[model samples]
Target: MGERLAGTVADAREAAPAAPAVLRVIIDAKRFPALGEAPPRHVLGPLRLTLRAHEVLVVTGPSGCGKTTLLNLVAGLDDELDGRIERPGQGRLAYVFQEPRLLPWRTVAQNLALVLPAGPDRAARIAKALAEVGLAEAATTYASRLSLGMARRVALARAFVVEPDLLLLDEPFASLDRATAQRLRLLLLDLLETRRAAALFVTHDLEEAVMLGDRLVVLTASPASVATELPIALDPAARRDEAAVAARTAELRGALRDLGSLP
Candidate 1:
């Protein structure tokens, strides 16, 4: 198992291209309209960051700290903010939101087929993605009929099927049960091992950040900005072990506590 994992990591390193920048964010400032009869409130600003190829950057901060807002800007979902975001012009992007956001009326396979381009092997691709997430048997099942965990798996499959250049995840496992979340996390790690993409995952869970991130970027309470950036030096295989995860989690917690951001 160890040798296999080492080989996988090596393959990933080789597959990853030498890109100067996959994503860049330069935010001079950001603000939002306040409640009725109030002035605009600051949200986030004066921040600059870059994501390289095949990197997983995790963002963690208190609730309402503009984490989602930052992702929106990167995804080009929101242009009402004060920021300049850059992404590779020819790159494809995929996003996994907190909610599964699947088409309830469609079957699992049909939902995945929506984003995939028409091709001779489209069906095969869909099947393979479902198998990856342990949902091959659920392909014909209606998305609305599946449990929350299954639904999330389908969502993940949809994202991976597109084979995006930049992947954005906004608390994809936020409301899942502990066991389900852990399983999905492993699935995510496995998928990332084979797929080379720059990913930005936003979550409030410190443990999740330490487990999934190449580097963790802690943000301020509100009007979020980078607080501290910590590189996770553990090997990908070691990070899966309980002891290693615990140690890394503790280290991240201490860092957050010192910044007064740990809840």
Candidate 2:
């Protein structure tokens, strides 16, 4: 009986469809201002990047270096850019902006429900996502009543509920107190592990970049291009260790210094 059950499990595993790749490549992509009487101002690109499944690629650069623009292009929010971006046809994308962007009048569950198609299990899915972010009890609370930290968690929960193929984050922790940001970071790491989605995270904070990225991509100022790529070699467990995070942070800083791209 045990042998038969094992064989059945193996057969099911073999019959299951393989997961699709996350993102293909951005080849020689560039973004420029609208063409009019004035000379066009270049915003970003002549850049190239690729992301794989379950990989976290963190982008860091000086302020106004077009990090957000890069993410916009990837998210298909801006197609005016020049170059080629390839994505899997079966993959879905999700974006988490710097702001929570919730409806003031809506409950937390309502805000999350906005993204999902109405189905029998939609409520169950929403409950599970909120629970994952430690917001199980706040499901019925209105957005206006929640604290900033709780609001941010709801935003994250909204994104994860979609089960995206690629997740784009534009400095979601910006302007938060250090303690709050730290807690969110840990929550994000845990969620990322469970979802295993390819992610592109943009941040001005070097520490945040080091903590979240499997590979860090540093960009040049303005009309941005890749300055350097540094791969973090630490184990996943090391990200929770202060010493490990500090060591990786120092290594990244040194690399930025060598490239003269440290902000």
Clashing pairs in 1: 43-223
The residue ranges of model 1 lying beyond 4 angstroms of the native Cα positions read: 1-19, 33-39
**TM-scores, one per candidate:** 0.88, 0.87
Position 55, candidate 1: lDDT? 92
Worst 10 residues of 1 by lDDT: 81-90
1-263: candidate 2 lDDT, tens digit per residue: 99999999999999987555577546365656557787766877768787877889988887898888787778888777667668866587889988899998999999999999999999999999999999999999999998889989999999999998799999999889999999999999999888988899998888887778888888888788888888975677998887889988998788778878786
Candidate 1 to truth, TM: 0.88
Q: Which regions in candidate 2 have their CA more than 4 angstroms from the true location?
A: 1-21, 25-29, 32-39
Supply candidate 2's per-residue lDDT for 34.
58
Candidate 2 TM-score, true structure as reference: 0.87
